[model samples]
Target: MTRDATSFDALYKAEPDPWNYETSAYEAEKYRRCLALLPRCRYPRGLEIGCSIGVMSAEIAQRCDSLLALDFAQTAVARARARGIPNARFEVATIPAEWPAGRWDLIVLSEVLYYLGPAELDRTVTLVAKSLAAGGCCLVAGYTGPTETTLSALDVQDRLLHGLAEAHPRHAIYKDRDASWIAAIFECRTCPAGG
Candidate 1:
């Protein structure tokens, strides 16, 4: 089953920061872990999908020459944009369909992939493979615990591993069960290896 815009809209309608990402300790630590796991210290260009409220986007912008953060919900995008980070841009765009132009040294799918079905996630993976700069990496983080959503964090990582097999990607898994989240960093091997 596809989780559509309405579900997300209702979420945003209830509260600006529905997930408490701005104040949650779990979220703060997860963001820290994601940043720590990056192979490179700085990325030339980075794209963060589903960057709700720009809480993490602001942090990530510090580590990138340029960053674009996109969310499907307009409220989320608006909240994220309000942060006013100079190096980061926020937009409303649905993934695998309204992708931005140009490749990126880093593409982040944080806590968002479980909202999709298998086929849609497959399309998203394909887009990541095509949009990623050679030797660039895609970092995917998600909550593994029970949720209303159909897919789990483990399911999302499994799809990435099997679907991107042709690209010969290098994978790193990091988990904090207490925080109920897991993240995987996949570095594409299709191009000449570079940091």
Candidate 2:
């Protein structure tokens, strides 16, 4: 099953920096690699799923004309908003159900997909394929370490890549895997109409 908002909210309430996003060297390096993997230096529009407390959102905002960052937990969203990223807007939203309308030039799914159930993951993959603009890119990154969720990090990336292949050609600009994490950047060379 997908991890519920209540559980995430409780986690944030218990610890403002549950994952130490702001202070962890591991996260800092991960974010660095993620930012470096982007094919372009700037994007007109961007979306970041599960932005947590906006540590990465602040960095992404520097490269985007406008960015929309989402987290289901109200507490997490509130914390992200408090960062006051000028070009980024933080909102409370759950994926595959509350996906924002319109195409995105860049969409990032960092350390979030494994929390989803199979069906939710499938739906999310479809949503991503349909919502990406032509020449747009989607970045998927996650911890390869053991997880309590139904899908492993690699499983989530593989399923998303498989589903996207059906909708559009996969042009992987970057892909990397280490003992701790795996990340890939898939570009949509040509999107179907209305995407």
Candidate 3:
């Protein structure tokens, strides 16, 4: 099962910026790497899951014509909305349960999947694959850190690799000197052979 919304709610209640995402240089660098890895310069439609505070979403919004940013925590959602990106929409939604309604050209799964258990991870990955538009891509990024959650970064990446079959996956391992984060992009096979 995915980590309950209550725990996240409690986390935000205790501290608004629980992950230090607002002032972390590490997070800023990861966001840079993520933006660089996207195949297209501009995506017509995009979705960002676990978009805490919308710091990264603000940058992503510039690259997308329409963006939907979701988080299970309402506090996070409110803070994200305050970023005031006109093209982006922020909402409170849990993954694999409160999924969006349409497919997307770019789907971002950043620092969020490791919170889900094996079953939820698998199901969420499957749903991600099913939701990708033709020739679209999904970006999955997470850090290799000690966590209270049930799934690790490796576990989530493994599930993504196995669950999203039939896609051309690209792995961008960000081990800059001593950094510990992995970002992967899976592009759907929308075209036929040689056509």
Candidate 4:
């Protein structure tokens, strides 16, 4: 079973910025590079899951016309909202459950997918295909490792993601340094909505 929203709540109850993405230089640099890869920086609509505190969402807001940033924890969502991303909407939502309506020009699963189980991952890939705008890109980035914690893990997300790539198409991947991290970009095939 994937760790449910309640577990994430417990995490936020412990620390508001658990990973320290806002203050950590390493995380800030990573976000900088993540934003740098946008083939079309001016995307019409962008969606990101696990948008802790919205630092990256703020960065993405600069590149896209509108963005929907989500996290399972209310505190995280609230903090992200306070960041004041006028063009971005912050919601407390869990993936593949509250998958947003309307096609997305860019979908990001930054540092979050690993928490989901295989079943959730499979469902999420399908949701990504359905939600993608024609020629839209999906970026999945997370900590790749054998850590004791769940969800923060990354490695095999690439396999699950790639196995579905043939059906989705426009697939491309880029990994950060091998030190327990990886990031990739994928584009879904032309769906009816996108077409």
Candidate with the greatest TM-score versus the true structure: 2
Which sequence of candidate numbers ranks them by lDDT, best first?
Answer: 2, 1, 3, 4
What would the C-alpha RMSD of candidate 1 be, to one decimal place? 2.4
Model 1: CA > 4 A from native:
169-179, 189-195
Worst 10 residues of 2 by lDDT: 169-178
TM-score against native, each model: 0.90, 0.95, 0.88, 0.87
The local lDDT score (0 to 100) that residue 16 gets in candidate 2 is: 99
Candidate 3 pairs with clashing backbones? none
What 10-residue stretch in candidate 1 is worst by lDDT? 169-178
The lDDT of each candidate is: 0.81, 0.90, 0.80, 0.76
Which digits, one per residue and each the tens of the lDDT, describe model 3 over residues 120-140? 777788788778887777888
Best by lDDT: 2
| Clash counts for the predictions, in order | 0, 0, 0, 2
Regions of model 3 farther than 4 Å from truth: 167-178, 192-195
Candidate 1 lDDT by residue in tens digits, 1-195: 556766786788889888898899878988998878887888899999888789999988998999999988888788888888999999988886888889898888888888888788899888877778877778888887888778888898778756655555454444333357787777765555554
lDDT of 2 by residue, 7-89 (tens): 99999999999989999998898888888888889999999999999999998889899999999999999999999888999
